[model samples]
Target: MSVSLDPVNIADKLSLIDELWTQRKIAGLNDYEIKLAKLKGEFVWHTHPETDELFVVVSGRLTIRLREGDVVLGPGELYVVPRGVEHCPVAEEETAVMLVEPVGTLNTGDTGGPMTRAAEPL
Candidate 1:
């Protein structure tokens, strides 16, 4: 297999995204995929039973709300939602985030509804 030596520019990739809550796959590492998403408003409460989800804030703020509490992240910060833990992601304003999860993992997790989307290549 071939690998890219050039950097994957986050800002450039994020610029290609027009819709909120849509994830764009930027790179892949092993069995995990690196994705970028623009988010606003609240997402559905869901859980990934098979893998943990990593959320890294690129711009603005994000809150990962859980039954236990809420984990807030700012630009350059990140949070990991443990597997099988129910959580909802909320962003007051337009937020740019990077998600690291297993390839083929759905954004909506256990609750598959309208918000669910397959991450397409950037």
Candidate 2:
């Protein structure tokens, strides 16, 4: 049997825990997944060696610092960081974001350290 779902309030479904960043799995499309994330402060600089990451700002603002430059995104804005491009995401305030990427893509990407951990499936 096939399972399906109705339209969901993505932001409302995210669990706000003690972690500086929280993510909820929204849905999966073939080999890709859509996730909702609530973030604050800065994330480690990393890169996905073989997958691109699509970020859609839901609320507040996010700045993606890249080697070449930085991209600032506001609500309803979207940006895609190509594979192998190093980036660090920063949110001066609490920000809600939606991410679309391949299912196996790690939140920490290529770099691994204290700041890196496999994304917990929600």
Candidate 3:
């Protein structure tokens, strides 16, 4: 007998990078989006006005910083930045993270600083 299969998983199909990668999409009734980001080094500081953002560390370590304080997240750790809050992200080494936020949300929020925005995937 022969069998056929789709042979692909949606969750695994979408990767934003060829090596180090990220994946994202708008989801939920509130138009929130889900994102998967992989990183190393430091990211620009920024904020989001209309929505809060949630990050979950899937592998390695992630550091989240704010003007007032900072937090480090390791595997299975999670963090949330309230709407209109300013924050930054950094990874000492390679790290994988998942982010959730509303659709049309700006990666940089109001700052518009360099690295403020992410280009929509083609």
Candidate 4:
């Protein structure tokens, strides 16, 4: 397989996504995957036992609710949920976010539900 050297525009990729809470893969790095998703409400509470999950806010606001406390982020900000930590992300309005995690990491982590989805390539 050949790798494309072209740039992945975050805005352009996000614009193509129509469903909320569904992540679409944009690129890969080593064994990790970079994905984009639009969020409009609350996500399921879950935990990733082996890998830390990264969340970068591209637009709007996101509040990651944890057992300890809530971490809020706005555009251009980011927060990493440590491995084994339970977290649920909430967005009051439409929000765009970038997620970085190991390839094949399920969005729902340990909690498998209807909201769980495999990140598909854009």
- Count: clashes, candidate 2: 0
lDDT per residue as tens, model 1, 43-70:
9999999999999999999999999999
Check candidate 4 and list the clashing pairs.
none
What would the TM-scores of all predictions be?
0.97, 0.89, 0.75, 0.97
Estimate the overall C-alpha local distance difference test score of candidate 4: 0.97
- List the pairs of residues colliding in candidate 1: none
Candidate 3 lDDT over 1-122, as tens digits, reads 57555453334633544434334442333566666666788877878877788988978899899898989999999998888788988899988777777766776678776554452441
User: For candidate 1, which ten residues in a row score worst on lDDT?
Assistant: 1-10
RMSD of candidate 1 to true structure, Å: 0.8
Name the candidate, 1 or 2, with the larger TM-score value. Answer: 1
lDDT of the candidates, in the order given: 0.96, 0.84, 0.71, 0.97
Angstrom error at residue 6, model 2: 2.2
- Minimum summed lDDT over a 10-residue window in model 3 is located at 19-28
lDDT of 2 by residue, 15-97 (tens): 44346565557787899888888889999999999998999998899999999999999999999999999999999998889
- Which of the predicted structures, 1 or 3, would earn the higher lDDT when compared with the native? 1
**Number of clashing residue pairs, candidate 4:** 0
